[model samples]
Target chain A: MTNRWTDGPGPRLRDVSEDELLAQIFPLLPRGGPVVVAPGDDTALVRTAYGSVLATTDTMVRGRDWLDEWSSPADVGGKSVAQNVADIASMGGRATALLVTLVADPETPVAWVLDFAAGLGAAAAEIEVPIAGGDLSSAPAGTLMVSITALGDVDGDPVLRSGARGGDVVAVAGTLGRSAAGFVLLQQDRADDDEDLVREHVRPRPPYEQGPVARSAGATAMIDLSDGLVRDAGRVAAASGVRLELSTELLRADLDRLTGVLDDDAALGCVLTGGEEHSLLACFPPEVALPDGWRRIGQVGAGEGVTVDGRPRSGGGWDHFHP
Target chain B: MTNRWTDGPGPRLRDVSEDELLAQIFPLLPRGGPVVVAPGDDTALVRTAYGSVLATTDTMVRGRDWLDEWSSPADVGGKSVAQNVADIASMGGRATALLVTLVADPETPVAWVLDFAAGLGAAAAEIEVPIAGGDLSSAPAGTLMVSITALGDVDGDPVLRSGARGGDVVAVAGTLGRSAAGFVLLQQDRADDDEDLVREHVRPRPPYEQGPVARSAGATAMIDLSDGLVRDAGRVAAASGVRLELSTELLRADLDRLTGVLDDDAALGCVLTGGEEHSLLACFPPEVALPDGWRRIGQVGAGEGVTVDGRPRSGGGWDHFHP
Candidate 1:
């Protein structure tokens, strides 16, 4: 059957029924990973190796979270998955499946949705997680939003941010401030000058495997750096009842990498205050060996809040409601 | 700490930071179920009795799903949770936890958000399920959307829509056509005429416990009636590769309840075609005794579509993209 919606000339969502759209979408989404009952059923069922499940959800809005001028539908899909899965990774678990929900204007093009699903499927496939099921709804014109709920399984105890103790070493896995740098470049219309940073902003590749590795290596507390480092670390400090003492000398490599693309102050600012990094921030016991790809940069101390070189540092990060 | 945003008079979402808003909401939301690590963490961890998890998601938009003039923020929150939990019920599972995501404009009032969370938390607590965690995002002006993902635990095999046989008898748990009747009343500005129907339209009370009851009674197949009766039954018919033979005589009680509100044709239409009822429809062996609270409505036969009194019937339901 030639679908007038999929094969026809630039069909919009309003031109097709919900079932037809779902039929087209089911094939585009990632499948085949611990799925017992998939999307055709009322609820998708997935087998869990562990008795417990790690659950997290994140939403992305069209105009607020990303502009159509800067992000394609595919990039938005990939980025949304990145942020949600990073939450599971930070919990010391591996994502088993995802439930996605998309609310779009009726005028949204069918092609755009397909590209988004394809990109989302590709990203989930890369992590071996299935897009088990989701919901779709039509919205008022010019409104587009996507949300993903990631479910994960952990073999042992799930890591929490409150587990950090005094004398633990603070370490990180993955880059810092690159996404913020990319945001700055996009704002300055200099995105072409730093393609790698710009790409990281659009589609973050969180180190999924390292989560279990860190857990196995006995990390005390872990969190994904969605907000700026100082801000997210402050959350760790508050939750664990300990202060994080940092040294800029240990972060010289991250700062130097951005110096070529930005001024010294801007580079330092991005490294300290940029958001949407999706990097792993974890604390290890002083005697435990740091896993590969982990970089130690700070230590846990008997105090509260974050500090840099013995001086207090204010938490500066993106707050969704704040400007 | 006095929250200038929540305690102050009518503060908008933009007036407070995300953490402040969350702190206000977390206290209002229902907790204490299988939650191991709750909302304060990167991801919430939930314990599941079954090794497999039943996952379903549903989304509701401001203008499309419900009008602010007609439905209160609490109504929206309650309705969203009802729809999601209904899906899990149809799968013969009890919901263990929920992850909610809200995307609203910056101008949205904090009071509205608090009411929404209160309603959601109350609904979840009634079923003994915890609101594990969620995400909040700011949207463009005039946009408000809520999405929920429910995770469930099933004791044994989940009843699928494809398991019905020709000798199965169809039964329905919960009311039919009430929400549609309420919708019509609301559209005609006669909401004051029947407060019960209008309330049902706003906040559906699905028979959540009857789902597991039906499963234990040896139901062959089951589905939630989110769409109209005939339409959702058609889905079961298609999935099971059998025809559902329904009788208007059997549905007379459902029709009679609405006849006072509308004409005979309209009443029958509402009974057969009203959506968002959140009722469960299940098929059982002819010899199996019907569970309490379930009324016999139809029979399964060897065919491919739905039939009303031996005549072929077309599925009629609400399509999100269609008028």
Candidate 2:
């Protein structure tokens, strides 16, 4: 779906007007009730229901992660916030706030920076978290590096990566491989100026609230789909001391979604190895009823490696450096 | 005081390890209460007097802020933690925890990453805070970016940059221009290998607790000396709509501390324009007695801009992007 507010290309960097992106995303966020103050403030205020607060930060450098021509400043900003927020989500906690640090080259216009900020603000608002504070600097090359820290409140207990049991049901919420499909689309769009795939490449719609939902659903193991399903699932498998097996038949729908749009090999590859969809992946007891928006993909067993249709998969997911 | 840890010459990147550096700096950190879990854990956990949490983050990139030859990875890590913690302190809060994100080229040795982590761990420990979580990524160029997010707790009311009153007395905790002086020393050190100044350039000793102390002492406004004194102080002066003036005599001791050790003009310039010392610059009501470890440096009045001895000064501060 096209975003009406951010649809048209406007004036050049210096002349473009400012639109409040935070206002758009703020109302979309899932409230955990622990947030004392949400976005649109100097800093977000969150109450720790238990003993302490958990925080983590990450940065995505433009040239390293995406090309400027393919991703707009807003897309860059949104992904930056989404990825960092996913880190917090992986811990089975709701993100309360975020702080962004940006570094751009001199040629990057003020409008680009503002648009980036708007995207970040919108993302934070969508998550019901605030853009608490940030810092800005100039880089030597035509590079843009965005660093974000996501703060979350640990309610009664934090669901750690080491918590899954042997017999838990591994499941996922939101679509997989779409981002990977979108990424390929982006590359092709860059070459041919194909608008459809270009849009998907620029913005991967992540299931933001699914994390908390899965957590509340008694998930024993949790992760965010950042580095493809197989790779991230492997992390859970390795961390939880259990083998995870995905059913190819169960993933047919996802594969079908990309069938006509992507090449056969590329479509399969995107589902197996795509990154940055920000979907929630979790493992729960076999008896638990799966929540809406969640699809059962795999099951946990008494082994270590992740498997596809009871067999070992060859390719590992996306690696920022290696990719 | 030469650091025995880094004494060896000639391509020591592989030989010198982070464990060795961490062992040296670990004992220097403040030990005891409020620190539930420290640096060795996947994430640090700290208890807050108040149930709520406050967090902020910032990142510094190489070439944009410092040169690698002059400063070690550990120094970069320490500065990252120190600066973010200072922001918490500015809010009249105590840092409970921190999370760091580091991006470096793959060619950057694992030892360097560890040392950087060690420095970050040491800085957090010094403030009785811990490194709760972190992310490591690879950069395309020979650049190092360090981002730190600090979680703080509000004891009562948060001291804001916008709260200074017209009649407040401006004061400072800790030395000013030392980092800047160290920077000059580092430049000379690069040219002539001046070891003395170079050491100061690496690990800056910020007055970590001064923020809370100033707040309790009835500070109306406060900020950290991340930027040079003039520039940061000017923020308060501008925000509070009050002119701030420094007593040159009060800063004489700080000046004398670096005298004979620096070139005349360079020394003055460093003291006036240096950044990243992380000292506390705050304003309090006229009736409040200055806290111990703090010196009265100036007074707030009905005017604009920062002044030295009732006269305006120029070219004596650092701006992150402008510089």
Candidate 3:
């Protein structure tokens, strides 16, 4: 209590009321997206295309999700937006708008809030999705969290995760293992030498536009690689009741890109076990042609869980509590 | 950390992986609303009505927003849904769906999460809005939180707070002072004696249908009383650029209802300064016939701010970081 607001230390959220904080952040919000009625209301009105709209929500908690020393406020905002938007893309829809909620301690710096807003604004601008409306509240001491809810519009019918079957080709439309490599680089204190790899861990760039592209090209099943390629693909495999046969040869391409950044085993592990990549992993009918940015990495088969080069990868990644 | 999920103590989240946790909670979700694609995917596809939809989000942090001793897990879940849904109602829309996120310690009980889900499910069932999609992540030890994003549909144009103008009559369709009085009752251990007041604090039932009723009755402006009557009325006044002249004579009726529960001054203060009531406060042209359950309380004029009994009340209600 004898800190920030009292000028005893750093800047504090308690110095200004929640109303004042929202007003300050209002000017920084982007209005370029499909917002019919902007913020500062009980609820924001947004435009959706068809009768069906896709929705998803995710959260990032400090200490558990990120450390302030390693990540800028902008990085937190961008990562939150990237992960949520990728969920919409995985649904074969366009991310239209987002409603965000930030919970912080009273001692949290105003600069951090503003920087987070900047990242959120930049991400929204990059994807053309508006920050429609959100809530701000204080959390228990020593805790700061950001939660985002993303809304999306589908073209016709949504491509679901349960649609993959035998004889389908598995493909990916974005980079993989970069985030994991970045994590390892950060762990090894090589972030300065490997800026791009570190950036991947701090701020993910998902192939959002490729979602609808895959849908248009008849993607049978799709998912976002938020929980690693093997685990997330296992989700699709379980949901579709089809075995996912992943090829280590096909995955070598991802590892090749990580050659100098990490060792062979680590690169391969990162490609298969890294989470938060936000890459689009999908399955398409064998006859369907793969679109640009999408490369065949595996195939859908008649058996059980995921296998890399005919070997089971039960060595999953990122267990929330246990980790 | 020694609690749930351990063999010697109890059930802990670490006992099951995130996938197992989701599977257990999925059956507890209510799918009564317009859900096209269900959970267990990257995102959920929901059916919308028109080209436009309403969106809002809110968060509740444990020990800061509520006390575990006073509120059950179900109460937290129900209250979270109630407040967010009320935001959509204030915009003159019907809430259609919600996406929820929960962050808790890995040592937290499985029963707590399941009970929270049950409360969320019951609330969704009560309002008929599907629990479309959600995320669960681990938090730092001893910290637990729940955040909700609500989606709503308007018939056509929404009733916004900025639309109130001169010669408009101000009215409300729900009760006030009950929640704040309930808060006091809980603090004093008077909750058992005043069951209704405690229930009011634990579970607020906002008059949702009355929102469209006001809109259909040609209401010009509207706001939800989440920040108390005086503060929220100030918002309407500031947004509409009008003086909101609240009649103490009219508020006497609200205060009168609290006579048996609280003192005169406390009741009046509660009616004027209590937040989280979620009552619909609106303005309609003088000619519009007042709908049932709606009662006139004041008038709008070419002025600024809010006045109670012809005097300015500069005092406001709840500040997130301060109060």
Candidate 4:
């Protein structure tokens, strides 16, 4: 298998080799801001409107979270940041910075760690966030685990899970089921060395800026798609005390994007039940025009449970323990 | 050994089993003016005066950082908070809050997780800093890892590692090397199961408030004792371009505390070289009266390297890869 060291580029640790994937990713970060500290310290520090900061953390482990054959270190790092940053965005906030902690086995190459950092750095930069600081530790098992804490600033009211109204439109920004579809493809091509599918499984492309877009669009309630559509939708449904009815026809274009790559059932399954898309799902007033890159997938009604084309969908998505 | 579920006098995760750990840690948090969002839905929000927040994360893995046989979950949780929180304090700030992400093996007892959270809660409460938020996931290995990110508000000046001047008074707050001694005792009594020594090894009592104390005392340079005095002191010495000379006489009290519990050589080794004490070491102008809970332990000179009583001390402390 091609490791990150031989396949990517970036600054490698002095004692450890550098990963090849990092070379392609590091240039994507944003620079210059009230970001007094970014991408290298213990944590990134940024200027907030009211001088208040928001922070959250998420951890991913190999075997349980991702497989080596399906993902590179950079992909691992990118997804780590994406999930944590989305948490910040879901609160109607802008991500300002991040801090990451990594634990890997001794047998794991140092280059993998460097590549992971670069991937995390690149992803943060893409969203104008920087890696402020991090810590590295050694684990005994052959596992690679990363913990990222994202910090953000609240410029307006934090759109909480409890904010959605009964008569709101349920919408989404960005593609769905791509990562999950990629996971299925990667599993099929694990030994075939399919770079494209593997890359998708490893590194997710989250709609980083869409959170602000949804907020500006006057969206009432929102969450990121780390879990499948139905599960994540269930969260908003349960919290907002409204039934969410999704129109599968609205998602036809998204499904078409994955058609040639996945079978009909797989594509539909991915779109409905896949997770880790990092897409923003929100409820808005009927009067609010759907923002660019956002699709109207459903509507909020006075009921409970999520429906796909007016029927209940089954087997939502992957759960850490259940999976 | 009593597990968390069986021992702790606290609530359990019955209906909230699927909820995130941040959900639990949030409501228990005491609200304050500095707190912006108290960690219900996603991230915890805090106000910073420096227009920037200082953040850091560290992960402690089972077996690598601690042995399950000797340590209780509470001890592991406390150390995780102590070490990460100490990083922010070393930068001359008080830990305002924290976000912890825990990864554990599925077979791991549920009781352990609760105990660990309780330990974290107790430690955060002790410092008056709440357990603002967190993430939890299952791992494949028999490991229990914790990653904590600590946030602090910078008041006046950020006392960076690159700040010390020549000829400064080197001082320390809180006791030194007790945890190291405790570690040694535990190692010797691994089979005996000495609860005191094991507790010390697991839960280090950091002088949490001493960070701000040293900062207010006009410390030119500061760091916490996660690495041994000489090693961590070396970091300040190298960063500040000054030499550090530690007086053994000032450490007599510490030596006395460990004497009966530890063999002479082992005790002295732990004191001078062992790590994770979380004591504050600072350099200031010689004219300043040492603050309360602080003792004059050394002098900053013109040359480089750490000298104990006049001779070079041995290099000792935990190394990430080597450990």
Candidate 5:
């Protein structure tokens, strides 16, 4: 793991006292807004200004979810925050605060935790979500993992996947396949040529603002592209008891974005089956003008499952365990 | 780890697909009430009628936090919930919902998870907190970890540790030192003599209903004894910029409870320096009437740190990394 530290000049976490380590991490934590009580308390008090709150939790583990050789600590931090935020957005809510649990081996570097905090703090600040409260603990040697739970505020009637009707138009609020392409590039050792793809694989930029926009404009059902387009869309289809007929013609632009970098088969598979994009997928009723950045990609019908150009998808998406 | 499993057997987690495992766990999840959306969603929606919500997260690892040989899966789950909820209670809040993240190796047992969920759901139901939603990811072999974040409702002015003032009475809402005595009992192989003490080590019974009781009775500040009495009392003392004067005579009863199980020095040490008791330690203004369950053991004064009969403590309590 130390050999994989591509960046230079920092002391290991083992060299610092726990109190001193926390002292360094504290200033980076978000403060002042909806966070009535901040870190260092038994629990943080937050005001959502709404009757309801949306919450979700996710974890990232070393060697399994990421390799230090391929990802910077900051990238790991950012992705962890992004994925949790995306979960809130998928439910048509805005994230208000986050609680982080950092479990690391004693030998882990102080710089890694600080860098990870930078990414987590930056992502939270970007969405106006405060880093509320969390615990830090030790793990067995060589293991470093993080768990983050995010709380969100639903401003109005909470939108859910069960609401998509037969006549609703399906849409996407962010890019797809780039993360998969970037992952492929990294796997092939060709990452040096494509910084954009590599960054996409490392730090996904989920459409956070678009979640509220879609909610305001009446999104029937929504999900984030965490398990890839086909599989996630299949979930929305199953939940709503409607068939999602996606048009590859509408996604021709998506295919066009990947044409040169990958072969035809690789590009097609990446677009349909790749996960970790963190983009928003949604179904909207007819006559609702989509807020900007959303593109119409298909329609909901009185059937089941997800289909591309009227053909059912043969392969599923990413599996966290198997992958 | 398998040898550590003493109970009747079930299928391994690897035997079922992740979806199948989730399906088995979902029916056991608690739903309805303030939960607008249940498990199996991108995120869960919960209603917090108050203007503010209390949030906290805690994690337990297999090897570091508990050995499988000493703790059943149900014990692990219950402890996880109890500890997290205790944090919220320490803040004078009522636990409302919980989001759990369980990371295990592929070869782990599915029944372990189902049983874990059963314990978690039962604990949450006991407190009226729904299981809500969370993510499951794979870990490297020989790893199993659980992280739970509890959201709490602060019905009124939240009691913070910093609020303790001079002349305040320092008290505890639940029994102290039993958990430490239990640990010693287990270590000495005399656990069979006192099943109650051993049960305290495996799963602490924190007085959940007493947090709000103390608050309503006008507690000035509060903290949970997760890290031991002397250490946690020192925290409250430091935060309030006051000295806590603990009386040995007052705590003699606590020591008496451990008389047979531990030597005099060990029993005294367990009462003062042991961790994971999860009891509420609080301060109340002199004029305020104390709650029924709470027992006064000390007093607050205009000074710093903590003292036992006016003498400073000789040693500190648990340090997560070092311990």
Candidate 6:
């Protein structure tokens, strides 16, 4: 209300109408992958393969999800897509389109929205998916929220958490604890010490292709390592009614990667309980060979819960409300 | 954070973990329309007919979209689904599934969430679409937002806004100014005098089935009247490169219904400039007969913009950022 729109280096959202803002943002988005009808209509029409589509949604709030000082608008945009894309991949599906929603304050700068759109468009383009359509709204002061719902299709059966059996081998397809380590370093004001860890924490690059490949190679169960290895693996254990036996020796590579930036106990903690990693964790039959990027980290056995080196491990991961 | 969870009649979100809250909510949601895989999975799988899916998303925020004093949790839930469902319908597609996202403060009451889910589930049940899956995250204090991404499929080609031609008859399938009139009544503290108007403002019951009906009957171009009739008609006009000539005499019935509660000028204004109305406005070839529920109010001619009785009308509708 105080003419914040005119005082900034660029125009704020309050200075422009919704249509005007959309005109500026639409050109920055990715188009034409399964998109029969693009944005600007009541609804967008996208082609679905195999008659079945996979659906998932994820939301991130400004203060709770990330700090502006730590994450650029582009980082938030790319991370939002990566998290949702990982969900589809975990289910053995390839993403085809995305529907995004941005609810921000009227005082939000126009540059932020355009930069965020660019980041989202780049991420979607990397995966060969289109930004089909989305909604934009203004929220109360100090509130900025973004959400993405990714739609995908699978050629064959989708992998479920309940499908793992006693003789299955557990594996992971990407880096572990890097995001969590990056957060810790940033919190301790050691961000300048390690660029890779900081970058991973802000913008993770999950191995999305490994998901369908694992499914094609007969993956019994799969999940995205969103809430860390311990908590997510426990989910698979409870759903499949079996115990996951992890060996520290098998996780040595992950631990070693973090050890250079953290103490021994801290490194182990990061490897076991880091959240927002977005890696794919899966289980396959013992007779089947592991996929190219997937490394065996554990095994499924007749029991419940997850244990490291035959001992029950504790220290849970992120919880939205309880945290 | 200071014991807000325990002092309430029901537990707050902070009192339970994400999984615990999800356990309570999954039961309150509708399932089994086109759902091949339900909630509790990484992503839900839904069937899409005719190899094409219609995608659209909308978001609502507290203190901007609605106020707790005027709308109950159930009303908000139902309105969210209705708005999204209307978009899909306007595109001449039958909604197959919905993905919802909720971002709330940690102090949000668990009972409020359950009630919201009940309302959403009931609305989806009425339309026979399943609530496939969604995300939940905690936001900063005093923030509550809800969003839904709807996926639908069309039997034939989708009716786009650019398809209208000159000499097409313009019609509407549902109420026009009821929602705007309702909001006006609420703002004037005249709630005790007209329950119907206030109810329409909070919970709109859109004519969902009429979308496909008009399409099957050869509708040329179609759009949802989410914004006021004038604004939405302008969109169709701009996209189709035609002018819409509206006649007030044809809108006499709509004006008459509102004049009982409002003055003649105010009634006409409401009918023409009301927002949040989920009715369908469409164009049809002059040779085609009007559908059962549709009423002719105008005609399409070669030109641009919308005209009322051969005169151009001004006065824009809701603009999220500008408003």
Q: Which ten residues in a row have the lowest lDDT in candidate 1 chain B?
A: B36-45
- The docking category that best describes candidate 4 is incorrect
Candidate 6: residue B206 lDDT (0-100): 92
Task: Name model 3 segments beyond 4 Å from true.
Answer: A1-50, B1-50
lDDT string, candidate 2, A1-323, tens digits: 33221222432112211122223222322333333432221123344433355566777887787776667777887888778777666656666656567766654555555556667666666656655555566666655688877666545555666678888888888787877776776666543434544555566656767767777888887878777888888878877888888887889998988877777788888888787777878899988999988888888988887889989875564444445
C-alpha DockQ of every model? 0.12, 0.10, 0.12, 0.12, 0.11, 0.12
Which pairs in model 2 have colliding backbones? Answer: A25-A125, A25-A126, A26-A125, A39-A130, B43-B132, B44-B132
- The chain A TM-scores for the candidates, taken one by one, are 0.84, 0.80, 0.84, 0.80, 0.83, 0.84
Q: Native contacts recovered, in order, as a fraction for each?
A: 0.24, 0.17, 0.22, 0.22, 0.20, 0.24
Q: Weakest 10 consecutive residues, lDDT, candidate 4 chain B?
A: B36-45
Could you give candidate 4's fraction of true interface contacts? 0.22
How many steric clashes between backbone atoms does each model show? Answer: 0, 6, 6, 14, 3, 0
Per-residue lDDT of candidate 6, residues A63-105 (tens digit): 8898887888888999998999998888787876676788877
Chain B TM-score of every predicted model: 0.84, 0.79, 0.83, 0.81, 0.83, 0.84
Tell me which of candidates 4 and 5 scores higher on lDDT: 5
lDDT for position B191 in model 4: 30
- What are the runs in model 2 whose C-alpha is more than 4 Å off? A1-51, A188-198, A263-265, B1-51, B188-198, B262-269, B314-317
Clash count in backbone of candidate 1: 0
- Cα lDDT tens digits, model 5, A1-323, are 22112122455332444345435533422244343433321122344443345667888999877878688878898899898888878877777667778887755655566567777777666666666656677787677899988777767655677679999999999998999999999999899877898899999988988888899899998888887899888878877889999988898888888887899889888888888899999999988987899999999998899889988874464455556
Pick the winner on TM-score between candidates 4 and 5: 5
- Which is better, 1 or 2, measured by DockQ? 1
Question: Where does model 5 sit among the CAPRI classes?
Answer: incorrect
Ranking by lDDT: 6, 1, 3, 5, 4, 2
Cα error of candidate 3 at position A6, Å: 34
Q: State the lDDT of candidate 2 residue by residue for B33-92, as single tens digits.
A: 333434331122334442456666677888877666666767777777777777777767
